[model samples]
Target chain A: MAAVPELLLDPAIKIWVLLPISIVMVLVGILRNNVTTLFLSPKRTVPNVRLLKEQQHLGLLRTYRRNHHVFISQSDFDEKFDLFKKEYEFDNLMRHYVADPEKLQKLKENPNDFNTVMSDLSSGDMMMQMLKGNLANYIPQTVIMYWVNFFYKNYIVMKLPFNLTNNFKSMLQSSMNMIDLDASYVSAISWYFVNLMGLSSIYALVLNDNEMVTQITQQTTQQQQPAPPTAGGPTVDQLFNSELEGFKITDIKSCFTTIHDRVLEKYQ
Target chain B: MPIVNPSPRQPIVIIMSSNKKYLLNQYKTSQYLNLSPPNLLQLFNSCKVFLATTNKLSPLERQSILELYFYLSILTNHDIEAKSTLQKLKESLPLTSKSEKLAVLESYYLEAIGSTNTSSSTSQEKKDAKQVSSSKKQETILKELEEYLTQVQTLIVNDENKSRAMSLTSQQAGPLSRMTTNDLRTIVKRKVALHKSFSSIDTYVNQLIDFLQVNTMDPFTWNELGQTYHKLGELTKAHSCFMEIAVLQPLNYKNWLQLADLEVELFYSGDLVAFNVLNDSILHYLRAVELCEVLVDAWIGLVVALKLIPVSEMEKSGVNSKLKPLEDLKGKYDQLLKLAAKKVNKFVELGLVTDDKKLNSVKAVLDDTK
Candidate 1:
């Protein structure tokens, strides 16, 4: 193995190259958060009432499945279960808007009809907001990377205080083409990358509950778009069927049947 | 300094007993507290004082204070203050926002106005010494509310249309300026509150059920439906509604107490599964007491429910396979009776139960169980 080439650059590189990139990145991140907040309106779009009802109904069924043994009697539980079953079969959930009975039946049969489901649940407002969020996320990083590359392309900005193995050479020393430079020495581009990722703590100190900042910043780290989680997932009918399956598997055990025993165990 | 003020240094003992707990505390509204006229006035004044420094508080704090002020003003029959508070809240909170709290407040405001209008007309009738135009005035009052109802209906229609247009055009969905399900429920609640006549309550029950069908998990609507059932003497329906609340919020001592009271009623009425429900009532009371150890009423209730369990059932060895045999279960009952007696005695000693007759009755019941 060859020894690393001893390279002592000017100390002024720390003041000129490193500080400017770090400070500019932090300021740009803060600015992007505020700009996104201004660009995206605060009002939440109301979902369709029938879809809302269906979602809430499914939630109630899930609660029942979890808590059948708590307080409800077997007869009452069965009655409610039978009622919900009948409603599910008839697709009474979307009765208000869905006029065609055949289409409703078809929907119940093939719940993965993505086109129909998407049309029913999608909101243009959400798509637009997501677009704006992506723009806010990518535009700044691109501009910052270009600015750093154009101005301080080949400068070795600073040496890390701690040593890193040669495995980090590709990451920490990206633009500077010196093969024997130790991996602990960070270049201008890698410094920008480090500042981009590591300045979250500094951003946290500067920002408050301004959620727009987090939403935009999170998109860069977490590649998953904050498209409404339910959208492009399982259709509502599919969710209903799955919840029904959960409800059906659980047997009703009323607390009344064993209350005396429980009380005795506690008191005695 | 040498004398040291030595006069037999006494030991300082701190009693450190728990404070008497209520299922519904002082923070609840006057309606729940059943506050008298003078106390209601005092509460209204204090709430007004809190409202004066709204700028200093956070947004959530300001909203809560404003809601408290609105409820107090309406209950205290201060029409001017109530109207102004409602107007102020409407300005601050978007009318189409999906918050049920605002919808409930608006319904209450409408009810208050309805009552005041009727009362004023009645007073005018008394001054004129005539009852001839009473029906006419009633008609006018109905017209006023109906006019407002039409306005709300039109708003709902407009919201529906806007949503349809958005769905078609894929346009930038405007702000959450849409009529919520709670808004519709609020209209029905206002109708129920104003027309306290027998027939409208039946319709209100149907409307509330319709609302609950959609928003199944809303505790507020469930509570409202339960109260309506209770008013109409449908104990079974009311029991189920209160049961939902108890299950939804198991930690809430008040819901447990309500359910237990209903169970006791159903047991006495012979409408429930007899022995099983009595045991359930005892369990509920035990839960209530567990939550608030100083709850004397729950102790009394526990005694009542425990006594109602037939001796024959307790003696049966094979009633439930999960339960212990006769001797052990019977001993458990005896232990529970002793526990209730001890708790009631402690409450009396702590000056919690001031009424002598009620105390004696509770003690007598506990002693009988023993």
Candidate 2:
């Protein structure tokens, strides 16, 4: 039930210590972004149009298979479904992907192993770019951390306006071992960490850099999806196969049966 | 002589319509007037304002504004601005599938310039299009379009090979593909746009069929093919194409209306079994009316369909009035006819920007029948 004591910090700390640390952190982060852009390859790989074509066709087939039953006659729906099923059969679609001898062997060994077949795919260039990005992120962070620690060690650089619980004490007060300091008094090194994490709004204001955003999204997407057949995602055959599975499960319910009553009710 | 007083309304009207946002909104609302001279000139003026404030806009906005400016200048026959805007689009857009779009735009620019040469027009006859026969000009444009099509094909083929090679070496797919879906759609559409004669339309129809073979699900191309077939009076083929679109976009009232109109046409042609065709037309009209009750065309079509259906068919088990007697059905049809007439008059009175004169004619038809 004891009231938390407020520290009367020196006024000069605001001018010399806190501002310099925050400003330097912001400048360093921006510099890192620019340096990363300069060092990285500007050549964004063009998406394979053939793969795009295949994907679009698959999408069309999917929508058709899913929606056709609602409006089309049963005979018409069945006719189209059979045609799509035949065209997208494993044997027919394999021609697009099985031009490779290894894929042919893999298909021969196991007809349904689409996942395992694509698991081995990787791009050396993509790997190198990821490594470069990690290095760019880490080196500047380490340099800033060292600079702040060596110069402004044991110094409380900021008193945060909002109260944080003692749970954040370990994180917000990393360098100092003061037992009685309030959790709001942020250390110089922790201030650098805060600016590094928190300056995205500042970046949005200062830099209209779509390239940076796309690069991050590309990295994340690369991590999320399976490596593509040509670049960094799934193969065309794999996509077609999944869509065929979708086709197999689709149920048809024609609209003709109820049209008579619907018309009469609307008129009535 | 009476001195004319300058009207206060004159400048206000100009200022109101000439406002950039107002013009853009007007253009968006009434897109059919896009090629009209006054609208084009006003849009071009507003587009110039956007072009001046280009630096403050985002890259995507700037690119779209430039594209709009390019099309407007081409339509307005401002050849220099058109070329410069296209050049800016080429430079600003990344070299990807967008390149195919740029190629299409370049072909559009070529068509506008009316250059016979594969390269830019170096001829002295650039402005003398009126002197030549219109057919000859179209022939030259088609030839130029074909040349550009071949050039794009080669580019796509080469790009495809490169990506194929890259994919083989690396397990990942390459960024470059030959021709994208958008590329194919635009190219086929360009071909479709060029033809006017019967023989050429047949050829274009064949080309569209081939394109559809590769892309089995494109509704736009299917609709284009259907419209072309309808023009050719090949009613069955047009029916099938419109059927495909109806299946694809079931909720679109316009598609239902189109199908209903085609069915009515087929019924009038007296080729197919009349009973089922009338039934289908009635269903389609009902569907269109269900989607959009205010659709004047659907209401008129419904009235026509009801009049066409035989009394025996109306009393039949599968028709709408299965339980009701023929007299009741007849009475209902009369009421429906009156309702259609009332709706048509109401819509005509509302004077919405739709074809009010057409609605009046439709109303007259409904009144005559009633």
Candidate 3:
């Protein structure tokens, strides 16, 4: 009776306690392995993602170089990266579908079926790969490490996160009613900051309006000064007056007489 | 310091000094500080006093003082004062023998009058009255004569001085004397006519003819006589003057052109005898064209004269002889038309002739000629 009682001790309770404890232990072990794999494992590193992104940016620049007319600097490159990312994603997706024309034709016929198939295939492939590497034992640690790298690449020095947060808040407000779950808020935030800061900084560095105004004012003032006197020549005022007097009206009939009189008076 | 009695010269000097100080104060206030009407008038009065007291000064000094007075008067809006100051300055200055001074004076007077007319309240009626006054007209005539005479005197003096100074005295004097004499005669004649003293026009014309006889080979002198005769309304004499010029210098296109114009005027006025004159004018133009075939005016005149020729006479004149003049004229016209066509082509190439109507009109004209 005592043995029976021990065996039958609230089956539900036993199941809850023992099952949870075992799951936790397994989880702990998996986390430990994941940590090692993410941080120290040699095989997890991908060689081509950075190179791919760099090549994508260069391709975009080449496309615009002949026809853009505007000069693009390093800052402009940062601004255009998001657009490149979208184009790259679409191109990659197209290439993936092009590799399997049967799947693409199925997709063209029924998009839902194609999506379901792809989702299932990708999930199955991920699980298989994870199992092959025994990364199921390291999933938690892998996630943590992935996050750490993301932070280091995108949010170190706090600027990236701050801008990202603001952009998220703006998008949340602007697209509050939109039901798109796949839209990337982080990418939007990055593009917003790049454009705003890049344009303002360039304008500040290139155009010095205050200095130009001062130069113009000084030049205008210099030109306004009166001309100087010359040697042996009558003063400007004297010459002006003498010219005036030479043409003045005197007695109508005796004008030359008056001129003669005036000339003689000065000589005398 | 006040206990000692001063001499009369001391009081006079003291008065003058005090007056100068007052004037200086007024000038400073008017020019720099305030510039009110009363202050300007005070400056003008002070300048006037300065001029009156400074009688023994040189013409240059007097000129400077008068200039100051004129400026002050203008600032004060005192036209009468400005005029008087200008008159005194002119009187005080020595006259140059050259016409340059007179010309400068005339221009200055005109500018001053224009400024006053614009700024002053003088009515249009008053200005018209002044312009129409016979005395004013005579005054203008006299001033012009004086200016012309001054030019003649300066030219003569300059020539004489040059002759005295140069080793090539005879050579220099001959052309210079001849030119100077011609200029003097023209100037005198113009001066007399400008004064409207037509009583001596015939005498002047006779004098011009005599002077032109000396240089019968000089086309310019003949042209001058022709112009003078034309001005005097002696068309026959003018035509003869140009004809003589055309005969002497057959290459002068203007002589032929003028002769043609005079003959055309006469022919248009119903003088059938003008046909011979027209023929003579065309012959001269043709001769001119022979000298310089590129003369465009000769070609144009020849075309115009051909239109005037009686059609009955066309056959009487030899076929080649009649066609030669027309062919030469047409050739020149074609050359001009080619230049015009080139310009029009450039415009067409530039897409400047956007209006279809204008483009069509130009094309039609070009096609008709073709």
DockQ numbers for every candidate? 0.12, 0.12, 0.00
Q: For residues A108-143, could you state the per-residue lDDT of candidate 1 as single tens digits?
A: 677566445454445655665556555666788899
The docking category that best describes candidate 2 is incorrect
RMSD of each: 11.4, 10.6, 40.4
lDDT of 3 by residue, B282-366 (tens): 5544444444444444444554554564434534553322113444443433444444344445555655555567567656554
lDDT of 2 by residue, B79-160 (tens): 8898899888888865653365677778778777666463554456555756788878777678767677667856765665
RMSD after Cα superposition, model 3: 40.4
Q: Could you list the chain B TM-scores for each candidate? A: 0.72, 0.75, 0.40
Candidates 1 and 2 compared by TM-score, better number: 1
TM of each candidate vs. truth: 0.63, 0.61, 0.27
C-alpha displacement of B191 in model 1, angstroms? 5.6
Q: What is the lDDT of residue A47 in candidate 1?
A: 56
Once superposed on the true structure, which residue ranges of model 3 sit more than 4 Å away at CA?
A1-268, B1-139, B147-218, B231-233, B269-275, B291-297, B311-370
* RMSD of model 1 against the true structure: 11.4
lDDT of 3 by residue, A1-268 (tens): 2321211234453254334333433344334433433433222112222223333333333433322212112233334334434544433433433467766665555544533453443444333333433433335435533443343232211113222333354442232233332223223223323332233233334334444333222222222222111112432223323323332311122111122223223322
Off by over 4 Å in 2: A1-49, A65-76, A86-268, B1-56, B87-98, B116-140, B149-199, B313-335, B348-364
Candidate 1 chain B, poorest ten consecutive residues by summed lDDT: B1-10
